[model samples]
Target: MVERLTRAVLAAPRTVLVGALALLVLFGLYGGGVASHLLSGGFEDPHAESAQATKILEDEYQRGGIPVIFKIDAPNRDVTADPVVGRVGKQLVEDLKQYDFIQDPVLSIWTDPVAARNLISKDKSSTLVVVPLDGGEDAAPGHAEDLAERFGGERDGVRITPTGQGKVFADTNTQVSKDLFLAEAIAIPISFIALVIIFGGVIAALLPLAVGIFSIVGTLALLRVFALFADVSIFTMNLATAMGLALAIDYTLLIITRYREEVAGGLTREAAIHRAMATSGRTVTFSAITVGLSLSGLLLFPQYFLRSFAYAGLAVVVVALLGSLVITPALLKVLGDRIDALDLRKPVRRALGRPERGFVPTEQTWWYRFVQWVLRRAAPVMLITTVVLLILGAPFLSIKLGFPDDRILPTSHASRVAMNEIRDDYERKLGGEVTIVITGSTDAAVDDYAARLSKVADVDAVTSPDALFVDGRAAAPRKSEDRHGEYRILTVTSNTDPLQDSGKTLLANLREVAKPDADVKFTGTAAATEDTVASIYRHLPWVLLWVAVTTFILLFLFTGSVVLPLKALVLNLLSLSATFGAIVWIFQDGHFGALGTTATGFITATMPILMFCVAFGLSMDYEVFLLGRIREEWLKSGKTRADSDHAVAFGLANTGRVITAAALLMAIVFAAMMASQVSFMRMFGFGLTIAVLMDATLIRMLLVPAFMRLAGRANWWAPAPLRKLHDKIGLSES
Candidate 1:
């Protein structure tokens, strides 16, 4: 099938090129605005209890949405005592009222003294003006930006800084865009230099980069299509571009290197393209399927953040694979003998001793010698590598998962700085206080419930219609009507970080104490974090099962061996454990301060799962690339133990250089994201870079050969029924 497709593409290279160009243009034009359509928040499970509570509050009370907070600083003056500051605050409130997007009756120091106690800074030098936006988070950023532009700096003896969910998200989106550009700017040139070194010719190097560019643009366009139907995360753009570029380089390197090898072996250009497509092209296809299947596991989670990556990853792999299989072969056919043109570094090739046409220089190559060394000491090498991986993975046992917050932004950012101030001075007053909606309840019942909640460990205070409870007592009697008048709203404050265990424990205690007849539901940042974590873990087993089972099946089809599939899965998981542990050590545990990122004390909840799927899929991608060659050699050499040994060495020698080059290219691209201002992106960059480097060198180069040597012919064994099934439907490059 691959041969037939390549022959047809080669037969009409210009036609195929034109079609590809047309699709590129169409998708680029249509999907160019994908960023505008992407969302900034997808941290909550939409159907979780917290989400349901939020919805009810938003619909009935008009109060549960994210608030736009303005930190107004009045130097050397108490905000309330200073007439100028008070006048400016009034004017700001009036200005906000003129905008339809701002909710009515904004809360500020001038509105109510009771609320003002919390809104005002402790030194009286600053105050907070909080207002809910009309369109929730999606509409808040624009309004916040407009408000900031209008009332940002030094207005009537006060400086206003916007620091809220809206401003934070807007800033994050802007930073991610800049980071994407920066990563591309750094990655592209470095990748080109590396490719030039690997291929030893400029023309040969440019082909992979061209495919990478095409794949990135095509995937972006595909993301635009997805954006039309669902809310994609802005973060997805980073994943799409990174994965697209990496996979393009990977698949192109595999195919083009094979084609060059076949051409150097004296095959006609047509036959060389056919043979390259039959072997490397088939490998690229299987690699794409395995990667696509692994990433599809992310879709099982409800968060759009994870789902968006799945969409982006699948698009990148498919588009890059198609580009490698179709366009690369077509371009190879057109280039023919000139594919090696623009050779600037001929001395290195001469030193390496270029082989004659129709011959591969395995005996003279370094990779062959390396594989020979590994084979001679396979058992010890395997033990050492496994031990190293396990030790590196040890830190993952202490990983603490939490939701991302303004801390994800650099501390130098205004929103982050302002939020830190808020967290330090007025944490008890901050809006993450847990809210409970009790339906079918009287005011007296709600008062009792609020009193009981206040007594829960870690609960700082609770507010209800009848009274305010503080330190487990009714500190003051209050009169207030439920805005909706249908359900009682009980607000509880905790002294613990809402995303951490203390706050989650307090929330659980609150739920346990609430009367079943109260018809109670909890909602807040802590509740949402709790629910999001639970939701992800609830679906995690299924996702892992799906990825494991499907990937096993895909590997079986590729290698026709159950043991190899299981072995590959184990090795990939081991490498991923190392990656996760590194993330925990560097980002969570704050061991690597040189990276210019502060530790958040917890990894983002979705990052581990997303990284596992991405890294595992990419591991499987390289697995397919290596195993395809080894499988071919095994079939050709008659599958004897001696032949199996020869096949492992020969296959490693033939493909090792390409695999290393591709891994280097991928690692460089991912590492470029470390330059990002966001801590999560840095963690992602560091984790993936480590994973690729380790997979390509230690696992693929040393461990794989060692394991195969130990397994011998057993590496190719399958049950008779399974063998018959594989014979009927399995993919073979031979």
Candidate 2:
């Protein structure tokens, strides 16, 4: 199949180039508009109980909860005594009524002064005007952005700063968009320099960028098409851009390096392209499939935020695979010997008074000698590296998971500023209130339930239809909004942030309280977070199984050895564990003060899953590259322990530089994400950087060769039936 494709490509290289150019233009034009169709929020599981409860709260109770909380401050003066504050606050409520989506009765000190006492700060200088938008989750952030733009600034000495889940999500979406552009701006130039240095020429350095452009634009166009069928998260765009360039460079480097090796071996440029296609081209195909399968694990998650990565990853990989297989080869066919033009190494060679080196590496190469040294002391080297990996991974045992809040945004953001004010200056977290609904419950039963709920630890107050309860004692009569026909609603306020341990414990205790069993449902930020985390964990095992099974099978087919696949999985886990531990120490434990991020005390719920899939797949990518060359060399030599050692050393010499370069280039792409304002983006960048570097250096370069030497001839071992199966289907250099 590759031979046939190579013939078709060599026959019409110019035609292939023209087709790619045409696609580049079309995709570029359409992909630019993808932002219009993306969503800012998709972290909730739509099928979870909390989601259903939210529907009831919105439809039956006419309470959408607060999307935007406006902190109205009078600057060290009492709000009631300042005429400007009173007039502006009243007018703000009136202005809110003009928006049809805003719930009919906005909550503020002016409108419900008695019930909104919790909205006032302890000093009486600041109060809140809570605007509850009636739209569902998708439209809420857009509404918040509009409201924040219109009424979020100061009006006659009364400052109105908006903050809440809605505003925070909006800010996150906007920041991610900016970070995407900034990350590219940073990654592209640095990557070009790295590419030039690695390839040792200017012309070859530009080929990967061409592939990157095609992959990115094509994936964006595909995502825009996907948006028509389902809600896609804006975060998917960031992944697409980063992975598109990364995979392109990885595949392009291997293909070009192989072609150069073949050319230096006295083959015609056309024959070299064909030979490179048969070997490196096959590796690219399997590597992409391995990555796509790993990303498919995200589909098991109910959250669209995760599933969207599956879509983005598959699109980028497929597009990059095509660019690598079709576009890269076509460019090579056209460039031919000129691919080595404008050699960047020539100037260096001149200054050193040396001649240019050819493509072929020798036994004197650093990787060959390095592998020999590792083989001599295989056991100790293996044991020491294993211990180091385990020690670095120890911090992952202490990982705590939570959902991101306004803190995910920079502290300079308006929503983050407002959240900080409420956290420090306000006695009550009005935005942190939890709501419970019970249908067909008697007033007596609800009053009893609310009283018990109010007595739970960390519960400040509970308002039921009968009366407001504070610490199990009735304080005042409740309002009509608390009752709707036979359905009773209770508002539970806590002094702690709902995302914290105390608040989660409070919710757990509330669930333990005895109720009428009349379809009681909890709906609020805390409830949604609980359900989202549960949904992820419930399907997490299946996700891991899918990634492991698919990857093991793919590696088995690629290497024709059951032992190699098993070893690959174990090594990938070890490296990924170290990466996760670093994430906990830096992002969760707040040990990296120079990163300028606020530690949320827990990793984001989906981050580990997302990182595991991406990093494991990429780790396996290098695994395949190294193993492919070793397998080729092994098959050509006699099947003996010494022959196996020779194959390992020779393969490392041939491919190590390329693998290390690809890993270095991939790391550079992810490292650009560290410049992002969002803490998770920074975590994502730093974590991937560590994973690729560790996999390339410690796992691939040192541990793999050492372990292979220890295993000796068994590195290629398989059961009789499986060996026959592999002989029939395994990829080879034939």
Candidate 3:
């Protein structure tokens, strides 16, 4: 089937090229407009209790719109009592009321003194004025930006700074978009240079870049299509561009290298293209499938943040595979001998009068020598590599997970600065507060429940309409009006940061405390974090199962060797464990503070899962590249133990340079994301770079050869029934 498809593409190169060009133009148009449809936040599980509570609070209780807070400071004066401050505050309130998006009766120091006590800063020089907007969280950013432009400045001896969730969201989106463009600008040129050095020809170098561009454009188009049915996170754009370019470069290197070798072996152009398609093309197809399956695990998580990556990854992999298998072969067939015509390095070699070295199996290459050394002392090499991998992975056991917050943004950002101030100054009221909604209960029952909640360890205070409870006792009559009909709301405040260990313990205690005759639901920052973590773990096992089962099946078909697939799985995991350890060390433990990042002492909960899928799939990709060449050599030689050793050395000699070059290009691409101001992206960039480097060098070069030598003929063993099944349906170039 692959040969027939290659023949058809080769038979109509011009037609295929034209059709691909048209599709590229169409997708480019669609991709250009995708940013407007993307979402800024998706950290919470949509079906979790916090999500349900948030929805009820918004729809049923009319608790909509994020607060646009203005911190007004007047030096050396009580802002609440100063004539100039009072006049300005009232005028600000009246002006806010005039805007249609602003909710009626904006809360300020002059409007309500009881609430104002919490809003006022401790020094009595500054107070907060909050204006609620008309829309949900998504609309808050735009509204906040507009309001900040109009009202965020000095007036009547008071200086106002606008800061809230909406403004933070807007700033983060803008920063990510900028970072994405910067990453592309840096990665593409570096990749091209690396490709040039690897291929030693300008035309050969540009082919992979062209495939990369096509993959990115097509993936963006697919993302736009998916956005019509579901919310896609803006972060997905970053992942899409990086994966598209990396995979395109990887697939193109394998295909073009094979085609060049076949041509140099005196095969006709058509036959070379056919053989290349039959082998490298088939491998590229299965590699993309394996990658797509790995990313599909993200779809099982409830957060759009994870699902968005799934959408972006699968789209890019599919598009990259098509570019490699179909369009690339067609281009190769058309280019023929001219593919080597643009050899910029040829002049230098000619000046030195050195013979050109083509990619053929030889004993003199460093890859062959290295494999021979490993085979000679296979046991010691394997043991040392295993110990190193395990030590690097040890830090992951101490990793602490948390949800992202304003801290994800750069410290210089206005929203981040404002949020830091709020967290420091308003610790009692705003920070670490748990909101509980109780339905189908009487007001007395709700009050009693609030009292019980206040008794929980670490609870500072509990506020309800009926009474204010402190240390499980009624301290004062609550002056706030009842905002309940069939349900009541209670606020539980604590001293610990909600995203930390103490806060998690407090949440558990709150859940453990009993409430009578009410359906109690908790929603707030800490509660939401707990729920999101729970949701991810609940579905993580299924995702791992799916990836494991599908990857094994695909590898079995690709290699017709059961043992090889298991070995690949173990090696990939070892490489990933080292990467995870590096992440925990640098990002979580703050060991690399000189790298210009602030460590929060905790890793983002979603990052490990996302990184595992991406890095593991990429490792599997390189695995297939090496195994395909070894299998080809094994088939050509006799299937004896000596033949297996010969095949290992021969395959490494032929393909090891290509694997290292591809891995270097991929690492460079991911490393460029380290320039991102966001901490998560930096961690992602660093972790992936380490994973690629380790896989390409240690695992592929040293461990794989040694393991193959040890396994001997058993490397190709399979059950009789499975062997028959594989022979009937296996994919092979021969």
lDDT of 3: 0.85
User: What is the C-alpha local distance difference test score of each model?
Assistant: 0.86, 0.87, 0.85
Clashes of each: 1, 0, 0
Which digits, one per residue and each the tens of the lDDT, describe model 3 over residues 467-560? 8898888888875543567878888877778878888899999998887777889988889888988888898899898888889999999889
Candidate 3 residue spans exceeding 4 A from truth: 64-67, 75-77, 98-107, 131-137, 351-355, 358-360, 425-429, 479-483
Residue pairs whose backbone atoms clash in candidate 2: none
Q: What is the lDDT of candidate 1?
A: 0.86
Clashes by residue pair, model 3: none
What TM-score quantifies how close candidate 1 is to the native fold?
A: 0.96
Which candidate would rank higher by TM-score, 2 or 3? Answer: 2
Tens digit of per-residue lDDT, candidate 1, span 1-734 = 77788878988998998999898888789777777778788878999988988888877877666677899888789888998888888888877877777764478878866677778777888899987776765667777777777777778658888888878888888899899889999999999999988887899899999889889899999898888888788888888889989999999999888888887888988888888888888888888999999999999999889998999998998899888888898888778778789876666557779743345488678898989899999999999999999999999999888888888999999989999998776635475489888888777677777788888887778988778898768999887655356688888866677876777787788888848365788899888888888898899999999999999999899889999999998999998998898889888888858267878688889899999999999999899889998888888877799999988999988889999988999999999988889889888888899999999999999999999999999999999999999999988886
Clashes of 3: 0
lDDT of 2 by residue, 478-536 (tens): 66677877777888887767788877877888899988858898977788888888888
| Structural similarity to truth (TM-score) of each candidate | 0.96, 0.97, 0.95
Number of the top-ranking candidate, with lDDT as the measure: 2
